[model samples]
Target: MSLQPPVYYIKSEYIETDTGNKVSRRATIAGPQNIILGGKTIISSGAIIRGDLRRTGPGHAVVISLGRYCLIGENCVVRPPYKTYRGTFNYYPMKVGDHVHIGAGSIVEAATIGSHRELIGDIYQSKFTIIKDCAKIADNTVLMPNSVVPALAHFAGAPGQFVEDLPESTQEMVEAETKSFYNRFQPLES
Candidate 1:
């Protein structure tokens, strides 16, 4: 299976990453393919991935790996491109773990945003903003680059700071709720 998105912009065509997989973008991708973007992965119309992917350099690549049932808000920019060097531009790969939710208009540029977190902001700009799982980011909060948010905390405001750590019990509740949601809608058995 090829994980490399085309270097150009594509519109309106449902794209399934694997070839010969019955689950076409228009059809249902099942089995091993069903596990990845095979089934529920939807790139809305006018959504462009790998726009002008640089063909050279070690890091001039865009890698987006979203776990099952992860929804990317419309008009959201995940891993936007940036200049890496004189002639070698690089595109940050958005590495989202399982069951994550990125608020609409929040820009996750080259960062490791953990699972089950809600990052709300007009422009969430950061490189390597490491937010642990089960975190809640308040609206319009600006998370500075290189910020590390521990798991199960509430964050708000510019350069978001930890307002509170979710008690272990609360964390367990969040995890349980999320697990239920994912398990219920997980791609039906092959």
Candidate 2:
């Protein structure tokens, strides 16, 4: 089947990406060529993805690969690693998995952010915020750019530092949350 988003959640119709993925019209996705959004993902209003600052390449090397069913909240900025090496400016790639929810105003500039992590903030401005699986970033915690956060941890700080590890061994909480939310809009058979 084609990688376009399913007709299920078309209720909130917004701007359709070139790949047929629905994104908020208010979202700012610069350089769509460098961004790869998996099917059924929701990018809310005011989100920004800087795909324009990529290095030259042969194939369509995606700078950001967001997996299916991922959610990017309002005002979030997802961009690749940017650095000026020897006066040469280039950006790295960023990969994200399913069921990952990034909240408002968060800036993600990491190489990868795993699944089941819910990062909530009012205005996340980071240069390199790397979040692992099953992690939760609390609200209003500004994360330093280029910081790596491990899995199953709960982080909080003015600049958002690692606070504590999650006691749960598995990702039951995340699984339940994603499944239930998705199942709600499923059309019932006649």
Candidate RMSDs in order: 10.0, 6.4
Judge candidate 2 against the unseen true structure and give its global Cα lDDT, from 0 to 1: 0.72
> Tens digit of lDDT per residue, candidate 2, span 68-113?
6677877888878777778876667888887777877777776778
**Tens-digit lDDT string for candidate 1 (34-64):** 1234224434332223333433655444555
Per-residue error for 172 in candidate 2, Å, reads: 2.6
**Once all C-alphas are superposed, what RMSD does model 2 give against the true structure?**
6.4
In order, the Cα lDDT scores of the candidates are: 0.54, 0.72
Residue 124 in candidate 2, Cα distance off native in Å: 2.9
- What TM-score should be assigned to candidate 2? 0.77
Would you estimate the TM-scores of all the predictions? 0.60, 0.77
Instruction: Specify the highest-lDDT model's number.
Output: 2
What lDDT is reached at residue 113 by model 1? 64
Task: Name the runs in model 2 displaced over 4 angstroms.
Answer: 1-21, 56-62, 123-125, 183-190
